[model samples]
Target: MRSLDSAREVCERFHPGLVKALGELTFAEREAPGSPVIDLFREHGGVGLLVPTEHGGHGADPVQAVRVMRAIGSMSPSLAAAATMHHFTAATLYALAPTEGRLTGAQIDVLKSVVPDRKIMASGWAEGRTEQNILMPAVTAVAAPGGYTLSGTKKPCSLSKSMDYLTASIAVPGPTGEPELAMAIIPADSPGISVHPFWGNDVLAAAESDEVRLENVFVPEDLIIRTTEEDPERMEALQLAGFVWFELLISSGYAGAAAALVEKVLQRRRGSATDQIQLVVKVESAFAVLEGAARAVLDGVDGEEAVAAALVARFAAQQAIAESTATALELLGGLDFITSSDSARLASGVRPLAFHPPSRASVAEALIAYCAGDALVLA
Candidate 1:
């Protein structure tokens, strides 16, 4: 129901401030140790900027969030990744959480209208390793009186250091031997919780990425959002669907980066030989691809249809951004590689695309699964 126009406006309003502080701010440097964008977003209530007014948020829609994230990702992918992580997580809660009690009528309105003003939360579904090639988190949760105690390590959390809250998957060992996945909201500073920086120097400089370890961390009953005793394989599939959505949102950020890079290159190319009709055609087509991806995201289709839409959008946006960045770099030559130029900043921004969720292999497999249907089995 929401459009990107208002969101674009919000991004435009904040662009100047963000750009002005881009270099000097510690968070702007992907390799730097601070999280400048997250700080600024919180200071400006950036999440609240687009969040609705009902649940203490601005009642902002997904389009607005997506557009703003794209803008940030254009300038700084690290910032975009951290800022948007929770939105997808929130979407998961909205889509899967029980529709009664705390998520009741008025509360639901607030959530849909203005999302809850809870501390920032991120999902921790991925496990550290896998047996039989299936990744499962080493952390597990055991039932306690009021809630469950969660313990395990969640690595490379986008904004782990700066977030106030997180939703981690706990290994709930069932009566049957197999474990169940349960989502819980945990405070960032809870005792027995440790944060360790994990992202490498080459990735988003502004990223405050860290690995979170919960050792008997207590999650109150109210914090437990969802639990299912359904087939582990089936539940895993549903979880994958939610994860796919998050991946799609992230890819859109790259599209935004591509658009920004094009604008930066165009400014200097005017009256130059590089601005030929063919070149213009290539660039314009690239831009169109990104815009189409954005459109699919805003359309709000449901189920596997939504997943398919997101996958297509992500693939298109990635291709366009890869092309746009290469073109912009080639056009700028020496100047583009310098850290001072917007070209350099954007180049760095696009680097994160190499490692985000639903990785290349995962995305490819997901596409296969979607196309082949459940009955189609692998040999």
Candidate 2:
């Protein structure tokens, strides 16, 4: 695992006061129903961790971003998960924008305001769906004079209740009247936008993973992102970037949760020396894989290669985290399992890592085919 100093440094560099504030909150307070931890995070610029520095926020590189996420996960996995949505939303906007040409004034203004206003952007992308449908929009957008009226529901939208803005994927009519994927950025309070309780479980209630419904929600033309069918390469690149960002950050968050479990076992000295050594090795190995993957992303490797590396790294980390957390639970014994809420919660929290995009079961065939010299195609 990363050194504590290194994790602290990442947090200090990107969000100076955030670590201290999170440390001050008890686990109960952080996970309580409608926890105020999100508000506290916003107060310390946590929402702007991935926004560019020139835009008045931290422009952390991929490695730094993952490190900060791990730190947050150790303290509060719910906060880490919610913040991942915010950071990734910012990252997607920047990644999808043209590199050299001038951006529309409205788009530029929205990006700039994210940090200054402490805006929390929720991801309204489809989730809990199969990997084949991951990027496909469940919502449809009807063409209008100035913009499109969108109607769809994104279930388990993180930060649904607290977000100030939302970035969603909508199916728009293409030139041939065929459904094509398009992204829309709109205010959370837009007319006809509503959030309903859909998470239906307490596992990550603090994340506010509710359902966001859009009914004839008009998204201005300026806020739309769409690529022509002729530009397959650009669309591929955009999707690859999203996958890299999502897998890396989500893995880091769960790694932190697993790390917390290890810490508790060590603090209590309940496990034997050999057990401690074994668990430490597994946790460290997972972090090492994750760090390597993050470095590949920051180094700007070929898009397809980077995506492949992220998938491999994420799966390896997932296995290690599962083993480490289960081991830690056994080492902590039944008494601690029954008496300690943090221990039980951390155990449950680590399970979500397996549920993130590009599930191993869904991509196993493609991954094997790629290893045997076939083209990599996730969908």
Candidate 3:
């Protein structure tokens, strides 16, 4: 409870009055289709939270970022889900800021316009593949005059109806004519880009996780970033940064959803002390692991180590959220379940964390190899 309260405090600190405004609407209203939650987030300057202050943004560190996500998730899981796409995209792009000559001028322009334009970016980098690393390119590209035409679809792309930019992973030829991974930052309003309905579930309808299609979409050479290393491992700096942030923020958000259910039971005082403490411990322990991983990132843990930490946090949270949500719902009792559908919906919202990118089974090999003193290879 203290952690959630602290999360709200951090939310208010970063985006003043955001928590109150989010709380103004009923959870059902906020979670419904075409909800105004994203607009609320934009109006409150949430898109700029992960962006640096010098770039006219809030400049929240990983720790504060996760805390904000928790607070927002506690209020609206859809907002948190959609915000993860925007935040992680911002984090990955700005991650290139420190190094001179790494970012093309066009790319820098995109990053600079974020805070000023209130830009919302949706990431299509994850393919959720079971055979190889999820970051492995799934988009087809053909070299054109001064750039390439990208053709692929990012299903379940969050902020589908409202995003201004789409950052996708594509494959382009390297020096030796082999296909290599590259980042493509394309405008959502581009000629050939379109959004279609894909997410059929209504659990987090406000997330706008729909299908984003790129049919003969052209991205300029300046907007595509390729790794400098010739034969870098499957996960490079860019991919690593994006993946770690993805896991941390996504888990924290789901933790918030579970927290909401826990809060209901707590507020009603329906359970014994032992039962209440068990619920709190389950959810808070998840938050604690997430916060610990975020703090480690702040302390300079990088590459595989950081990614491993994030995955551990995410998987642990997945189990904790599952167990806690069920326990909390039971503690709330059958009367609550029969009286309102909110508890059931909230419980379902946290279940997707287990189904998100780089699932527990998919990464077992990499984590095991890393533990055996071998370099972490995600392929």
**Highest-lDDT candidate:** 3
TM of each candidate vs. truth: 0.77, 0.94, 0.96
The candidate 2 region of ten consecutive residues with least summed lDDT is: 95-104
lDDT values for all models: 0.58, 0.81, 0.87
User: Taking the tens digit of each residue's C-alpha lDDT, what string does model 2 give over 49-126?
Assistant: 777767787788888988898888887889888888888778878764445443467777788788888889988776
- Candidate 3, clashing residue pairs? none
Candidate 3 ranges with C-alpha deviation above 4 Å? 127-132, 229-235
Candidate 1 regions with alpha-carbon error over 4 angstroms: 1-8, 12-31, 49-53, 96-98, 102-118, 127-138, 173-178, 228-241, 270-300, 336-342, 363-366, 372-379
Note the residue pairs that clash in candidate 2.
Answer: 1-284
Pick by lDDT: 1 or 2, better one? 2
lDDT tens digits by residue: candidate 1, 1-379: 0122343456757443554454455333543567566676565555554343544655445555556776666556676777667666665555543434434343354345323343566556562222111124445787899878888887766667777767665566555866666556677788888887676664565656678778898887666644443433534554544555465567766666655666666666633654533445554454354445446646755556655665566665666567667776777677546655556666657756655544556557656876877432211
lDDT computed for candidate 3: 0.87
Using TM-score, give the best candidate's number. 3
**For residues 1-379, could you state the per-residue lDDT of candidate 3 as single tens digits?**
6778989999999999889998999989999999999999988898899898888898999999999999999999999999998998898888777678788999989999998888899887754434445567767889999999989888778899999999888888887889888888999899999899888998989999989889999989999988666436532677888889989998999999999889988889978999999889988998899999999999999888999899888998889999999999899999888988888999989888877878778789888988899888776
